[model samples]
Target: MTTQAEKSQQALILFAHGARDPRWAEPLQRLQQIVSKQVSGDVLVHQAFLELMTPSLPELIAHLVQQQVAAVTVVPIFLGQGGHVRRDLPELITQLSADYPQVRFTLAPAIGEDEQVLKAIADVCIAQL
Candidate 1:
């Protein structure tokens, strides 16, 4: 069983494929903010991008490791299992795992794969028509 201290040492990383435009990161950052507030103080929520953005995955992981975060879950904020999500991400995770052997990094499915997100997207589409 996981104790409070164990949970406190865990972090959630909201992983996203970044765009060149700064504005592209606003929603993702906002999401990190929202999730951070909702989770227990034991957990830390962060946003990291695959490319064209600051705080790349490796960078964030390095910082978190220094902060003594024991475990991490990476939730890809992508809508589909594209190349980035399917291939690049796994490679990155592999390297990160090798680099930070002490930290546990788990990758969750891409956000769009969730039923809730699909339903919400459908609702928005239906409302728009």
Candidate 2:
């Protein structure tokens, strides 16, 4: 069970590889907003990009730590366990966690290869069919 120490002022850090087209950020931002509203105990949400964004994951995590957040969950908003998710994110998380030991950090699995994702793709393909 996730205790309040792990729950209080919890932040969900959504990391996405940004798009040159600014509009691409919208859907993830919308999803973040929805989840932020639903989670219990003053859930805070932030978005960090692998590139083309002001705050990277390390920077965002540091900012959340400065806010004295009790805990945070880093969820990669990538489509799959691609190169960035497989390599960069883990290294970044490790470095940030080392720098800030007080704040607890949880790294969730990437939203890749899930049934829901497959269904979504199937639905899109079905439309073409």
**Best prediction by TM-score:** 1
**What is the C-alpha RMSD, rounded to one decimal, of candidate 1?**
3.2
Per-prediction TM-score, please?
0.92, 0.83
Candidate 2, clashing residue pairs?
none
- Residue-level lDDT of model 2, residues 27-109, one tens digit each, is 98898888778886577888888898657787887788766697888888877888888898888888888898887888877
Q: Give all candidates' CA lDDT scores.
A: 0.91, 0.82
What would the per-residue lDDT of candidate 1 be over residues 1-129, giving only the tens digit for each residue? 976444438889999988999998999889888999999887889989899997999999999887789899999999998999999999999999999999988999999999999999999999998
Candidate 2, which segments miss by more than 4 Å at Cα? 1-8
The deviation in Å at residue 16 for candidate 2 is: 0.2
Best by lDDT: 1
Model 1 weakest 10-residue run by lDDT: 2-11
- Worst 10-residue lDDT window for candidate 2 reads 2-11
Error of 2 at 57 (Å): 1.0
The alpha-carbon lDDT assigned to residue 99 of candidate 2 equals 91
